[model samples]
Target: MILDIYKDAFEYSAKNLVTLFVLGIFCLFSFLLIPIFLITGYNYRVINTAVHGVINGKDPLPDFDDLISMFIDGLKVVIVQIPYLLVPFVIFVIFGIISGQLTGILSNAIMIIGCLITLAAIIAACLMSQMGICHMAYNDGSFSKAFALSEIKEVIDEIGWSQCIATYLGLIIITLVISFVVTLIIAIIFAIFGVSGAALGADAGGIFGLGLVINSLVSMFIVGPYLSIFNSRSVGLLYTMQI
Candidate 1:
């Protein structure tokens, strides 16, 4: 059953991944040069809606369109709210010192504990925002309700700790692996010419850096769809587990 779950998860990821990317790229490139993309203006909302829709087995188009419109509507809201995310991050940094203190004091135990708490806080913050947006996209919920402290259990319970950590971790790992392999190959090519890739304009590091940013979106493209489907199954699984 676990194997089946794993297979279903990965296969589900692959199919949806392709669709999300193609659609995302189409919309993204369509507005590439415009200033709006910088704000991630419409592009963000569209992608968010589509992603959530796909996960819930709804029509992705509505989500995509809603995302676009939401971006336009929420511009001011975004400007106001974006900076607040930093607070928890700052908390995370402060706690990180405490977490670090674990090593010398308790062989890193306290530090590890502090770090975990900080990470949990950071995750909680992001999760809250995600649920807020997803709930709005899914059900016309208000942004306030979305961000309310109450809905977090629903998000974490539905998504599961393993899946959330794995999803974020997987995307990071895959992106780094791809970026590394590509850079190494590029470096070797440059090395044959007695040129240092980083020293020359042909900097793999820059390419990797650029790719990391691009790849985050590409991850949404590549892995996000599968996540939606897997999440759908997870919802059902949650019901079963509860029973």
Candidate 2:
């Protein structure tokens, strides 16, 4: 079942190169903030399409038409995510502050406890937010549905906790592997061009700097959007188990 979800997600993402490129363009400007909304909004569309079933024998992927609506939808997605992420961040910050006020073994112990709590909070938030986003999409963009904790728990139960945890952990591992491989390839290319030995001369340093810029561009504009689409599509398909 998980394999089918990934296979369908790959096919769905690869169906239109033009759309993927457009998504990459938005991702490139994601630092500008507005573009992120469009990307998130597009992911919401993907989830909505998957949940309702694609119609008319047409591509399930949505277009960039109606920019205003896309932005609005994207804003909703951000709103849903903020609290889930924020709580963990706040917990970490509070713990850091509290830990700093003490000294010696007591301080060390408090910091360790804080770190554990923060880590747990982060993991919980990650698990909940994925399904929360799906809930929002399934309910026709109802913002409140995303935070419907009881419903979210019930949906997770229906989907089976073991399957949900395995899927989430699998995605994390896949992402880490992809990131490591991409970074390694980039490093190898730079090394081949003598950028690795930048201590040799100023010219080597300049070349190394250029390589860094190129690597950043590739990561932001190419790899980032592809992964985003893949993950979003996978989550959307995974949610179908409960439906």
**Maximum-lDDT candidate:** 2
Q: List where candidate 1 sits over 4 angstroms from the true fold.
A: 1-39, 46-52, 55-84, 90-116, 193-243
lDDT (Cα, tens digit) per residue for candidate 2, span 4-102: 777777677767767877888888777999998999898888877776663222446788899999999999988888899998899988988998999
Give the whole-model CA lDDT for all candidates, comma-separated: 0.48, 0.81
Instruction: Give per-candidate clash totals.
Output: 7, 0
Q: What is the lDDT of candidate 2?
A: 0.81
Estimated TM-score per prediction?
0.49, 0.84
Which window of ten consecutive residues has the lowest lDDT sum in model 2?
Answer: 51-60
- Candidate 2 regions exceeding 4 Å error are 54-59, 193-210
Put down candidate 1 lDDT per residue, 93-135, tens digits, no spaces. 7767666655566746765666677677766565455444554
**By TM-score, who's the top model here?**
2
lDDT over C-alpha atoms for residue 197 of model 1: 49
Give the Cα-based TM-score of candidate 2 against the true structure: 0.84
| Candidate 2: Cα lDDT at 207 | 69
